[model samples]
Target: MSVTAAEVLIDTLHDWGVDRIFGMPGDGINGIMEALRFRQDRIQFIQVRHEEAAAFMACAHAKYTGQLGVCLATSGPGGLHLLNGLYDAKLDGQPVLAITGMPFHDLIGTKTQQDVELDKVFMDVAVYNERVMGAAHIENIAHLACRTALSYRGVAHITFPVDLQDSEVSKPTTKRNVPNHTSDVFAIEAGFPSNRDLDLAAAVLNGGEKVVILAGRGALGASEELELLAERLGAPIVKALLGKGSVPDDSPYTTGTIGLLGTKPSQEVLEECDTLLIAGSSFPYIEFLPKPGQARGVQIDMDPMRIGLRYPIEVGLVGQCRKTLNALLPMVQQKEDRSFLEKTQKGMKVWWALMEARGTNQSTPMKPQVVAWELGKQLRNSAIVSSDSGTIATWWARQVPAKADQLHSVSGNLASMANGLPYAMAAQLAYPDRQCVAFVGDGGFSMLMAELATCVKYQLPVKVIIIKNNTLGMIKWEQMVFLGNPEYGCELHPINFALFAEACGAKGLTIDDPQHCAATLQEAFETPGPVIIEALVDPFEPPMPPKVTLDQAAKFAHSLAKGEPNRDKIALTVLSDKVRELI
Candidate 1:
């Protein structure tokens, strides 16, 4: 009997080093499911509650393992559900392969059930998207899809028609074109900028008196080179959220995060610098970046198009981060005056002091900052942390210190919620021995909490730290910041997440009092299996921006006058420090 297309595809994936696939079984994918059953020992199929979670797990798996993550879904809604998580991978620049089952080849254009045009649906998110037309196309398509995902460092997709999946390849085609699984077929090389561009970038850096280095995720491989360049130039390094682990947080010249979820010291460094040297970060939010003409900009990015897109560039160096930095380091001159670096370092000390004050506050309901800070201190060196988007992100971004060998991730460009749990689960699955934690808000956790059962089923010891504030904390704060609008539709009904976790067959703990914070967290971490620590955090604790402007203050006053709850608390915590600075 001839090998079916599904079997060939599965063999190709196994050859490509895909040990696992995350998805749910459906009639549309029966052929693939059967193939999985036959290849059970070779490739494991991780069943997830939702296809969205599967996509998220794949994205996180790719991020944590530095390998192409694979996910599958049946046709129609199931395939559509993968878009958000695929976008997360696309935006965050993780390599992922998404396989979707389609209706029978003859029924594709007809009004058959579960028949949807998947190529169009995934076109926006995928770097390479195609549909397999015949059994002869299976091996080549699979190879190309996997290769595209890995080489381009983005999402690649393949839609297999149900009829084609079960079809057998002709003997001649099968014999002439045997599947090849050699590692050399998937090898990719690092990119480097030309000498001319490197010279220009160096000249720009040497001309500036006060240089500020902004590192992004692209700079992860060049930490030593970045540190050397920063030290020689007397530049303060500020990290983009995705770039948090590129350099250790404790570096003498490292300013934490920059932007809305950033530190005042980072903002100060950007504001005072005469030159901005951005490395591998396509950080959006141009308002938070140095204003046009405020500083001469030198941007280093692998993509030539992204070099000057974010900020006006005096020099745009297009190459791999480490290679580019290595080349540019020799061309630039060492700075004689280290005053700007000294001043930024001093400002960082003050910013950290203020953060410690907030974290140690002995308030009634525990402050989220305190929880995050304590968690940071208790984390093992090999820990991987995944943060959900929202107020919890602020705590994770600012409170948690990035250390060497530690991994930190969030739904960066997409800023989607509910990704924390799936991300942590993937990290735990990828590195079973290392500690994995997900910091999620009450609102975000409710979106995909069903995945806790997946964690239980797999016995993945991923700890969840849910900041149960019973509110959409970030939206509530945004309403006050943007429109001075009073909180509306932002409140969430209180949930006993601990009970929910217990129901899902995982360990659970609820901390309502401030004193129980550490003990409960420690207990949850010690649990043998999946655990959830639902800390009822103070809802009134504001996620203040690095620099509060007069306009922001006016909006806050308007929100207070409009009878927003916790006005007094906001005034005490957020405004008091500003008031002190003014006085």
Candidate 2:
């Protein structure tokens, strides 16, 4: 049987256990699309509304499933569209393979339609990028792309020229047809740090009176070890937003997330800690971390580059979180002083109380935190919750009381908007039995609302909660806080997202009144197919920082005095918080 390059590549992926590929089709990928049709039984092709959504879905697939995520796109413009989402994967460290088509090999430098230099275009976002020469080149490129992406936990790209897609392999014929050069078998072992290195880390952790452990996305599978380490060391575990699921919110020791969209207790603990043990986290906010020399540090990470990248750590233990911690446990000594842990625990109680007060507040325009808080209550134990970048992220970070079994993620480093829907869709696809929710702001939802049809088409039961504030809420507040400028160009024209969802043939529900927030969210979660819950939360609800600085206070005052719009509402909202005791 004479096999075309496209078929060869597709078949190889199927052997590698690739069940699906997210993409939208076009003429440039005609041969590849035909190849997919032949192998559709083995590898399902998920059609997305946009190429950007395809890449985002691929990234989310990897995050949720712990497998290789693959997205396909046509030549030129379609490939360009995938860049934003691919960069999201690159920045957040997900394994993804992006296959893009080129116009034709001979069409190069001819300025033909969709004649893109795609390999070069993807160089910045992809760790391993190469262009396929012909049918004989398929195995080499496909194997390398898949392997590199998994090994590096980053993006890999392969560009196949339209002309060569259907070409049958020619006999070696003096060409460099290096055959059987690779195999599908690849494994990333949970390596162990040397006993000597573990001793060094244990000594650092044991010596300090007040120790703090910051867990990031890298710490996802090390929860048992983490709880044990914290118990022995008498340290409180503070999670970064990406690491929210490392230890559930109900775990007495976790001080929640720490940054702008963080808890006050997390901030206080980080500032006061005498020793810091970083477990698979590279939290970027240097200001919120302990002053460089104040806290002696010990960090555990698989990537040595990230171990001491954020803090001046004396010990850098390079290994997987669970494995490294397992090895280090024996050498670690119990710390008798429980004062710091007790203080942080007490602080957590006050923080949650404040969060509860903020979350339950009912007003004409419903509180946004109420939606997140109630959504937290409604989420299935085995659910996946995704948030977009904006004030919605703040609510998700602070209000979503996580269960140990639930998975929570946001667009971490890239902080991209319009990612919630795609992320939820991918999560739903990955695990159809478990629930998936998208917590999106109005501005963010508006950008990718068309994916509502994609959800319906795929029969993915994703609950989308749209915080319907008629403004670009985060940027508007940023203008007031950082620049001390009056809010301008932030207002969004109203769109009844629920009505739009109904029009899209999906279930549509709305909660304009505060009284109906809980019941409406419950209904949304319980509904059968894709449901969009338009929650009319207060646009004036401020996205406050974990701790306010004097400069920030002055800037906010200057903005208000200079006639920031909705000044009266802002004043009432600011003055109304009675949860002021802890700070």
Off by over 4 Å in 2: 173-176, 578-583
What is the per-residue lDDT of model 2 for residues 185-288, given as tens digits with 9 covering 90 to 100?
Answer: 66565457888888888888889888999999889988999999899988999999889999989987899999999999999988899999999888888889
Residue 157 displacement in candidate 2 (angstroms): 0.1
Query: Candidate 2, TM-score vs. the true structure?
Result: 0.98
Best by TM-score: 2
* lDDT by residue for model 1 (369-395), tens: 889888888899989999999999999
- Assess each prediction's global lDDT (C-alpha) against the native: 0.89, 0.89
Candidate 1 TM-score versus the reference? 0.96
Candidate 2 colliding pairs:
none
What's the TM-score of each model vs. the native? 0.96, 0.98
